[model samples]
Target: MAKLISLFFGNAFILAYALDESTNQVEAINLKDISLPITLDSLQTKETIYPIPAMICFDDRIFYGQEVRTHKKFFSPHTFLYMKQYIAKNQHLPRIIGDQEISNFQAAEILMISIIHRIEEIYGAENISMYVFPVPPKGFEIFAQWIEKFCFRIGLVSFKIVDGGVCSLLAYGLGHELGTNFMYINFGPMCLDLYILKVEESSNEPRLRSVLLGGLNKNYGSIDIHKSLRDELIDYNITVRKAAEIVHHLINNQTFEEEINGQQLHFSRTQLHELLNRKGYGQELKNILADLIDLASGIGVTYESVQYVLCAGSSLQVPYYRNILKDFFGYKLLYNKAHNCPAARWSGIPSASGQWQYHQGQLRAPQPDSKGRRL
Candidate 1:
């Protein structure tokens, strides 16, 4: 176990360097007068642990940073339009079996692969061996088959599918500094992941124990919410979609310094709360938010037996949501400040005890290290 942990951490460093180098390459190209240093620093700080160069699209706006940058540079506007069409045609259907459908997985994989292909074009496909961990909801077989077909279509010959919540658990286990019980909550599109973690019972030494998995209420992930918002505003409906989109745009674009309705609208942190607090739309918006909160609470109640919750996700970017969690779960509830993509390059070594052996074809017993350590 220790060896495996060490190997992963070592790889994390190498991946970090490669990602940093790619960001520098992008920084070399000057666009929008954005300085290389600022971009470099931003990328370095925001995505130190991500394994490869990828694009992260939240809502309609895209974030192109060092580790997870959008592929806006390579594709034309028409290309994006086609891509959106393909996504909608294939993915926008509701599933009868599980929380998601085949189309849903395909859409996500296509987007992720698009980012991967963009990075490979820059860094050479020979060096890019990627893995994806898509969180699975109840009744995952249907979606799994869909993902398998999508992987084949995308030419991803070698890949692995892990439960998204489990991947987060793997990261959290590896990231533990002290032997204290911890809880992880991953809020994604479709569902939320709740995991209860503690030290194992058998081992005298501290290590991650069995996980108790639960899910919170279901809704479209941040991406879905953002898209809904954009659609509503485009249609001039002051619905949940519009409110969500406005908040999403401001957070990602940061230059929320736009003039709308002949009034200068500075979408600072308080924009969501302020907008929701307004007269007519407030009630409806509050209801939507309340539904999301209820979902979270429902999931929390399933694990209500446990305390110490840590929230992580793109949606957590909203301050109001965090406040809601704190109020509902009490002060003991916390948020994860780690980069959103912790699974790809998570660090921290776990200690595993066993014998090691290296052979030409088969292995024997575990060998001792220089310090006479067996594992």
Candidate 2:
């Protein structure tokens, strides 16, 4: 059988892995610290070139310092947009931005080719057959067929689009008892992903599996704070980069000082907190959490029966969300701070050991790293 590949296309970033069909294990090539140059021509080209560690996008874009600086020098000041909300518009939908009309299909196709270029550098050109990926939630599949067709158009044959069950389970190393119910929230810069799952025993194997009861992704992420802070400093001509740096400093429990346009602004943690309060970040958190609680309630996962809440991904590394998870979920919360899982670790919710949702003709969710691998 051709090897399977695993990919996680979260709002903030893209991660891909090669699956060992024999051992069912995959290792990630270290790519986080490395940065590749961005080009207008590469977006439309697909022929051979030197391999590099980089990625494309689906809808939203996130740029590290490297690309931002490069874009400012070579392209327009608005060459790229980062930490933006996920727009669920259909393919071919007319959208106007910066006097340019670009359809959703064109953007996604560009992202696909760019992603394929990255994958080529990782696993060679033709080593993959099957794929395992995660989608946001209920409405994700509305245009999922386009993704499958895109894969084929790019020469990939088979694919699977599952929910966020496996990533959450392995991320926190939670218990997978049949009755154990857990809530997973992946807080991005511009979006939040919530999943409530119940562990169920697999009919094909002796391992446990998590089944999604309800899932939701909404526009409540760290960018919301950046937006709020921008409003508070509307008088200052602060760029998004400058404002984001200030927010980062505050999140790290340090005073923030930045020169916006010509005026210098400074604030301490206490002041940052007051600003957050003034802009109702706490209230927004309450609203988002309340909605998640309602999702849990809809799925019959009461506070009493719910085993724990797990915050997956890198957002909790920030101070505000770290506090939010603790304040809201309290002692029952676990957070995934490690980008790489340990070598000896295995999934608390095992999927590869069993026949995946294979019987129902459903795509199998991506499993965890059986060995330590970094994105």
Candidate 3:
């Protein structure tokens, strides 16, 4: 029988899977070394007529592994990255990145086309009967309209669009528990999405969560970590690449430094913590906690119903935010780890912060209600 494919449209990358013949069973996944890019070739003619606006590369090719901070000479003309957060967005696209003018629809189409291309390459076009894609929070209606166009353009006959946070729940494998609710907080380059999931009582299947909040921090994320550090280190004239290396060293080791042009730039874990605290990120962490409490309470999230807090993002893996999450969720804090789910891949986050999705704890899926089932 032909296989069913599920496309994971991440904030910075695109990953997909082929389902088993059995009902809703995921047989295979890839977690590492499959981070794909989104690009559009300005050189390409409109008459070329792609299934979508963007492809893995519209009119050119891209090779990863060596880090390229700025697209400049390294990337092709018209190629773009970090556009996933803008798909289905109501606002105009952000000012050109890498001298590329990208529409939200184009970005999403490029990403979708890229994933579909990979799927077709792997399983053959005729083998794919349907697709399962998760939509960003606050983008259900827009995504629906966009996806309708997407399916028509791509000739996808059937598919399902669920909350992206719910994909976190599925990817992390929430256990089945009665009266327990799962809270997932994901930080992407463009925004942070929060999803609160509750299982149905009758079928024990996870359903649409009551707590669905997104775009919590539109202009903040792991990128801010790099930008803030790079800007601060600029006082001593450290290069962006060196600053990125220093940031990486801080995440893995206790202290680190580099000599650039015979100038010593170094910082220990103490300085790292202090820097974050001095910067607005520490306050951003606090703001996140406070908002969680307020939103949880406002949405009727009680200790009785709320069971666990799952942090699923490369940005959240940082000890800085993990410590705060620990304080808020305590033992209930479950994180996503790269080791646990080998079949997974970074959900389109940039390499700067996205690669740090080391390991996070896990939780049990909530028990569904006893009436009509929603999975």
Deviation (Å) of 11 in candidate 3: 6.6
- Give me the candidate number with maximum TM-score: 2
* Cα-based lDDT for every prediction: 0.38, 0.54, 0.50
lDDT of 1 by residue, 56-147 (tens): 12211112121112223224443244334434443322222222222334334544455455545555666544434343333334444555
- Residues 35-55 of candidate 2: C-alpha lDDT, one tens digit per residue: 233332334432221112122
Instruction: For model 1, name the residue pairs that clash.
Output: 2-352, 64-69, 135-164, 189-221, 229-241, 355-366, 356-365, 356-366, 356-367
lDDT of 1 at 332: 56
Between candidates 2 and 3, the lDDT winner: 2
lDDT of 1: 0.38
Total clashes for model 2? 0
Considering lDDT, which of the candidate structures 1 and 3 is the better prediction for this target?
Answer: 3
- Of 1 and 2, the candidate ranking higher by TM-score: 2
- Native-to-model Cα distance after best TM-score fit, residue 298 in candidate 1, in Å: 11
The deviation in Å at residue 248 for candidate 3 is 2.7
* Segments in model 2 whose C-alpha atoms lie over 4 Å from true places: 1-7, 10-107, 118-132, 137-149, 156-163, 204-209, 258-264, 338-375
Model 1 regions more than 4 Å off: 1-116, 137-158, 173-184, 189-213, 220-255, 260-263, 277-307, 347-375
| Local accuracy of candidate 3 as per-residue lDDT tens digits, 282-351 | 7787777677667767767764566777665545656676777777678877774521221222222111
